[model samples]
Target: MTDRVAIVTGGSGGIGRAVSERLAADGISVLVTFSGGSQRADDVVTAITDAGGRAVAARADVAEPAEVNALLDVAEAEFGGVDVVVNTAGIMRLSPLAQLSLDDLDAMYRVNVRGTFVVSQAAVQRLRSGGALINFSSSVVKLALPTYSAYVAGKAAVDGITRILAQEVRGRDITVNAVAPGPTATPLFLDGKPTEVVEHLAAQAPLERLGEPKDIAEAVSFLAGPARWVNGQVVYVNGGIV
Candidate 1:
């Protein structure tokens, strides 16, 4: 996969950054994308390049089809063609079903569901044979955690898209899969939670600890590169949280 390229949305976030660096380490050129954090994305590029890997940073709103198409243009222009597309861009606004704000719920769906759809559509059209599209879901979909109904609903859409897209891409040798991570030690998961709450969630996993970003990245690396037989499956990377 030394000559292959990837486009990773939300590439500046905790899990996104880990996946970006991990792919680079595996000899894949990465196009690191950020919606607002240009500096953070650039830092990821710098880290990759400084480590003797290849990377470039750009800004693109994953929900916008035009912007996503432009990103594909950049990847092809920069590194020939895209072989992997990772949809890590998502948002979470916790509220119960009765109390959930429509605005917040719409925001999550826009970024998590619609954003994944836009990018996946583009990837299915543009990715070369042997390519892979990895979408993001959450173990919370199964865990059905309180106050996460809206967020889980959006990810549930992602699950459906992954399964259908894999079948739709038949004979192309391209795989579509979703990674549902359980409680992990990312800012997205840790931001507003109390320490005791975090500890309790961590202990719910058989691993008895919070997941590191690298743990999820490892699963992504497999799907993106060598795991050709793995397709249309939602691999849970949450250390047995179910």
Candidate 2:
């Protein structure tokens, strides 16, 4: 953990931006990877850099092994070594299990499931001892919400991978865990939902509000830094929703 470098995929998005910035605030160098929203990603880097933090932006498709490997190589060459890798790159298409298109499910699986696999495979090689790998899961798995079967199916797979990988890396000093976020105020969650629906979900939480990106980022910051003892766990940041 000499350099304390972190590679955050989908680093342009709301939660990703917060995580990158928070980790940088903690004195960790960040390698932000984005597939789109290049300008947004650059803005995050600039914010971190202006604050005297080290950060760089790169393009990588989390689903592609070569691209993911190249992205990690960028971190190694630029920041020395990777201490944390957070997979936040994912897409969701809402549809009932019966009406869901195979294409939508396929696309989500490619980016969400295979993407996690590709990145984790690289982490399996690149992450040093004492390093941590954080994967994103959804509280929907436990909520058992309808029209989420396909998305939940993919995330359910992530849950399995997180658990098995934790055990597989037994002696390695590496901690593998999944951060299951409840309905948060990210484009991924807010988009396509009506205000009433959003409000309904928000009120369901014990906290009586939606989670901010900073809230979720705080969780990742803890896991990536001081929460070394918390491994193979699904820490839900859903404000006591489930």
Candidate 3:
């Protein structure tokens, strides 16, 4: 993959960082995009560079089509072309269906659904012939957990888009797929949950613990690299939770 250029959104945190590092390790020139955490993004780039990998950090809000396009422009200018695009930027909120507000729904959709769409659209335009688009979904779509209706719904849309996108780009060598992870041990998973609640959630998984960011990243690496036959599918990396 040394000849490839990759763009990973939300590259400052958890799964995004792992994905960026893994791709960089594989000899792909990585563009790490962050929304607000420029320091953390730079840290990731530094880590990769220190390890003898090529990478750059840029700030962009994936929800805005303009920003997404600009991010592509930067990647193209720096790396010559984009061969892989990973959309890992998303948000979540816990609320019962009755208590879920429209604002909450819109907020989640804006970042999760709309953001993935915009980023994927931009990538499709500039992606090389053998390009791959890996999008983030969630195991909650299959687990059907309560209080995650809005978040899961948004991911479901990503799943749908992934399938249709593959067909749309059928003639091209580009492949589109979604990776749905179970409860990963990220800051986002820890937020708003009590210690006991977090433990219980972890234990609920069949593997007896929550997933690691690298676990999901491994799947992403396969899809972005040698797993070209795997397209238009949602590969769940939830440690058998779903």
- Pick by TM-score: which candidate is best? 1
As a whole number from 0 to 100, the lDDT of residue 37 in candidate 1 is 51
Model 3 lDDT tens row, 1-242: 48999999999999999999999999999999999958999999999999999999999999898999999899989989899999999999889999999998998999999999999888888889989999999989988888999898999999999999989997899999999998899999888899998898899877899899999999999999999899999999988875
Q: Which residue pairs show backbone clashes in model 1?
A: none
**Model 1 error, position 147 (Å):** 0.4
What alpha-carbon RMSD in Å does predicted model 2 have with respect to the real structure? Answer: 1.2
Candidates' C-alpha lDDT? 0.94, 0.92, 0.92
lDDT of 1 by residue, 1-242 (tens): 49899999999879999999999999999999999958899899999999999999889999999999999999999999999999988888887899998999889989999999999999999999889999999899999789998999999999999999999999999999999988889999999999999999999988799999999999999999999999999999999987
TM-score of each prediction = 0.99, 0.98, 0.97
Give the least accurate 10-residue stretch of model 3, judged by summed lDDT: 233-242
- For model 1, the superposed segments whose C-alpha errors exceed 4 Å read none
* Residue pairs with backbone overlap in model 3: none
What lDDT does candidate 3 reach at residue 158?
97
The Cα error of candidate 3 at residue 236, in Å, is 0.3
